[model samples]
Target: MIKIISCILLVFASTYSFACKDPLYKDKYQITNFSGYSDVIVARIITSKHNDDEMYSPLMSFDAAVLEKIKGALTPNQVIHVSAKIEDPRAACPLYFKENSTYLLLLERQEGELQISRFSFPIESNNEHFSSYLSQVKSGINIH
Candidate 1:
């Protein structure tokens, strides 16, 4: 009975830990579009599982609104660094992708191209930490 209770508690703790911190979590992923949409950068995550495919499937999309704001405060063509907490679509599926369940992104526009310079994740789940990290990333960039 004690063992059963301990296992139940463990499962509950793990589940609570896995919940996302920010409802508006955003991730930075590299994307190159020649459509003059560089001013409006978008983030699309491609699963590692689909590496062999020519096209990258977008897990989600986020407008670089925070990055835009940062740019507005800085010089033209200035690089803006920001982080967004990304959701794992595979978390719900038998369709798991890679081992790391979350990712962070750093993005900028250079020479009419939107570039994602960084993508990584934390060791554990923390929604507040994720949101704060993204906010810090947004604040670091000179969006103007």
Candidate 2:
């Protein structure tokens, strides 16, 4: 147990210096056409699975239940596949979603697969911006 805890601490400690903190939006990844994303949805992650592959590197694929739809083809209560690239070996990034946590995601659809936008990051429910996002959506304003 001690060894396992030590390893966990080591992994996080090593990554923390280089990793992007959760729910942070750096302006470098900002999108100009923020209002024109093809698929934007507010969803709650239901399940999470980790995959490490050559094409995707280490990525997290989540099953999320739609709580609200901001645009595009999704409907409330629908489940969608959400995937995020985790470039730990190079960038020290890890999976961003937590099970049962809600997120506002901007997406791009590619050949029937829904992918999180390169310009955006999932806004986790606990993020400082989460409430502002919901408020903007409620008032029909630009989200971020």
Off by over 4 Å in 1: 23-59, 62-107, 110-112, 115-144
**Model 2 over residues 44-144: C-alpha lDDT tens digits?**
98997766554333456779999988778899999888666323344434555678998878877666787763346567888666776655554553534
Taking the tens digit of each residue's C-alpha lDDT, what string does model 1 give over 1-144? 999999999999998765534233346312222232223322222333322342233222222222222222233333433322233434321112232333343334555344432122321123446555544544544332
Question: What TM-score does model 2 achieve against the real structure?
Answer: 0.63
Q: Rate the local accuracy (lDDT) of all candidates.
A: 0.35, 0.67
Ten contiguous residues minimizing lDDT sum, candidate 2:
85-94
Q: RMSD in angstroms, all models?
A: 12.8, 7.9
Give stretches of model 2 more than 4 Å off.
1-32, 52-57, 85-92, 135-144
